[model samples]
Target: MNATDRLTELFMRFPGIGPKQAKRFVYFLLREHFHFKEQLINALQELKHTGKQCERCYSFFGDKNLKNPKSKCHICLNENRDEKILMIVEKELDLDAIEKTGSYNGQYFILGGVLPPLTEKPSELIRVRELVARIYDDITNDSLEEIIFALPVTDYGDVTKEYLEKTLGQIVGMKNIKMSTLARGLSSGLELEYVDRDTFKSALERRQ
Candidate 1:
């Protein structure tokens, strides 16, 4: 493919970009401020270079202890926070959104991605098994009490949440797992960020 065609193809690979959107982006980059092309390239290159996933919570960032330091992520290391309640999120963006509210004092677990049936094996992409082990480890070792699920409202999100709840229930033997979901007052099909702050806080407070 030509260079323009190649860039269009690359842009299309992004989550919400369609062919037309990709073409517009490429044209804009080429025509509007060509200097930004270098910035884009540098940003993409630096993305991999800067951040490493936290060993404990799996949230990736450019923290000092990201590699092998004694301390974990700030949330994981915060002694004042309640480790007993864990909030599981689909993406780091959603985690950030919730964290901005400053309402939730509990720690978090990031699933990395929602579950999908694209794989032949059900266990392929989703890591509910490891998640379960983490929960059990926390309960027995760290004395955790509840798990709040903050997954999106998509089909994949719903399925993954159900799978986790069922698996944890089976493994822990009883609903000793006080599982909860984002409250329904928030729009049924909206992302966590689109909802207003008041509603988001309300949803968190009324989270079930």
Candidate 2:
């Protein structure tokens, strides 16, 4: 493949860029004299080696933590947060959405992805096991009081939540686990990230 085709292939790998937009971006970079091209190349190269996943949250930050990883993130380490009240979310995006609301002061457990038979591998579900182990280890002989399910308000999200609640619920005990979900206000925002701060805040307040 030629340089233009090569650039198109690279850009297409990005989340939302289509062929037309990728071609336009490549041409723009070419006209701009390749500085952006060099920058993109350098960034991608660094990404291959750096920004490892945090062992605790599974969120990709930088490599320093990966070298000497911590069992908890800054939020998880915070003394003020309610360690007894845990919230399980499907992805980092959902976690960020709740954090932006400033409504929840509890610790978080991210599942990394939902359980969809299409792309959901059983190994990917190990994160849920990690959550169970962490709670058992951290809560001083498994005394966690609450676990809020904050997955997206989708049909798939509902199925995943029920599965988790059943599976982990058995290991952790259904009596100790009080399951709650975000309010309907979040439905208006569809994409959790796009929700306004107030909407998210209200959703948390109305959470049952």
The TM-scores of all predictions, comma-separated, are: 0.78, 0.77
Count of clashes in candidate 1: 2
lDDT per residue for candidate 2 within 1-208, as digits (tens), equals 9989998998999889999999999888888857777898889788787756656566665453446546456786678887677788778877777788787798787787777644456446547678767666655645467777777677777778777776676756644556677776735534565566787677667778
- What TM-score does structure 2 among the candidates reach? 0.77
Put down candidate 1 lDDT per residue, 101-182, tens digits, no spaces. Answer: 7778998888778876343454656656668778777866756778888888888888788777766876555536678887
Off by over 4 Å in 2: 33-49, 63-72, 117-126, 140-143, 186-190
Cα lDDT, all candidates: 0.76, 0.72
Give me the runs in candidate 1 sitting further than 4 Å from their true place: 64-72, 115-121, 154-156, 173-175
Error of 1 at 172 (Å): 3.6
In terms of lDDT, which candidate is strongest?
A: 1
What clash pairs does model 2 have?
A: none
